[model samples]
Target: MSTQFLDMRISSDSVQDTPQRELTSSSLFPYTFGDIGLQTASVSPSNVNSVRVTLNAYVRLLMAPSSNPTIIPNATFTVRRNGTTIFTTVYQKPANQLDITYEMAAITVVDFPPENEVLLGQIQYTISVSTNYGIGLGARSFSGIAVAGGI
Candidate 1:
């Protein structure tokens, strides 16, 4: 068995600041972080017996409590495989906290059968963030890897 690496990162400069009574959630474009939006990794159909996928997320935030010191943003991370939702998690933050960094991870395993395989098919993964209050994510990153083993 061997492993393949998948790296992704994304950043947005459009900062959103809303009050506790007027907060909204948004999704960043799905793609590799440093490169364009989509990234693909190969999956071996015939020789592989099972596939394992893992994800890691890092986020940077800029809190402006000085503007509305009573509100905090609730953040969540969602990961999708092949345009299908696979994992979701929420990031916890203290109400009075200022600038901070957040991190998370997810993992899953699946059987790889040659009968269901598509030629040159690739495994695609996406990471997105959702927030419920006033806060800005200055930068965000996601790294994923897949390991396939033969029977």
Candidate 2:
């Protein structure tokens, strides 16, 4: 079966030398770093059955030492759709490391069957980050895209 592309949407925040945002909570909470909104055309489930989402970001994580030197530093990146979690990625600093930075990408495909396909209208995508042992985020560029397609 040939696939049909129904819609596509993109959003981004590109800021050079952006100020660092401190994250102190070890728990995984909604700390929004980026967001995007996509409006999908109303279609029958037989016509479109899935949405492909891609997220990219440049992140800098600076680990601050805690009172106990042995505690490891870690950070988590999460992707949510309409207030529901769709994907999550975790970064753990190597033992004795003080800081790290990198560009990360996450992708996921959401499937809908004909009987229960309910994803329609306006959709919201959110990106959140959290760290343990205190960490700073700086000079970042975050982007996301949503593509609705069917086979």
Candidate 3:
């Protein structure tokens, strides 16, 4: 994608730091409830290339201690722009450790709105996480931040 990311910001101290959010296993689907966050800024649609979009997030997921820590958890992260899906990925949380942290990063590209109009308004950035298995219905935490800047 030719779209660029501008003004990246991390929710944690820095892009290198991984933030963790707790995840409780779901009885309904084995996956924990979605942990969602949002970041926004205004932009000038006329300057699509120059238009700044905040992105580049680093996520760290910590699995709760359990008797069976080897089950492994399936994790999914999604990023959306203007209510449109721009990026998505799935991975398995690492297993076996006193305190295990699974880290992942995402870099997003700006998608021009339909009809290429000069949009002078607020823009939306979204981050969400979904996980299943790990520790078998056990509680865990996933931490991450949006690293803002232009690609």
Candidate 4:
């Protein structure tokens, strides 16, 4: 089997000292923190068969009794491709934990079967976080690569 690289795209952002933004919501609503747009090369369905996407994020989870004694801090992270969800993760900390930093990473591969027609065009990937109490995002990175191979 042989494979060829078709296209690649990456987006990254970070804050120096403080978090980029402190997200807090009484309702469960996702806040988009990072996004990237990738233009895939037009190729024959027989030549391209898969796309790989990777995402990384640095976040601070804070749970303070003084701030919100009634509720425990929890956050849900989601990854979407063109508004469609592909992956999701959740982080929760006890009130006693106070503050913690986490480095999260996720990867996914989209494959097109031989019988199905391949769709290649503008693609967008986004990372979002939803919280109940409070959460902070320090950095985030998203990347994707399209490859051609026999499927």
**Model 1: runs farther than 4 Å from truth?**
1-46, 64-72, 96-120
For model 2, residues 2-101, the per-residue Cα lDDT tens digits are: 3544445544443544566777865566467777665555544554556554556565666665556677767788877777777787877667654454
Clashes in model 2: which pairs?
none
**Lowest lDDT block of 10, candidate 1:** 13-22
Model 4 lDDT vs. the true structure? 0.59
Give one digit per residue, the lDDT tens place, for model 1 in 33-130.
32112222354543344554455655565434434555555666666666566667665566666665343223232323232332334555566656
Reference-based TM-score of each model = 0.54, 0.70, 0.48, 0.70
Badly placed stretches (over 4 Å) of model 4 are 27-29, 58-70, 99-118
- Candidate order, TM-score descending: 2, 4, 1, 3
Q: How many backbone clashes does every candidate have?
A: 2, 0, 22, 0
lDDT of 4 by residue, 32-81 (tens): 76676655556545664554333455544443333656777677888777
Q: Assess the local accuracy of residue 133 in candidate 1 as a C-alpha lDDT between 0 and 100.
A: 54
In Å, residue 124's CA in model 3 sits off its true spot by 0.6
Q: For model 1, which pairs clash?
A: 9-33, 31-37
User: What is residue 17's positional error in candidate 1, in angstroms?
Assistant: 16
Displacement of the residue 126 alpha carbon in candidate 1, Å? 0.6
lDDT of 1: 0.46
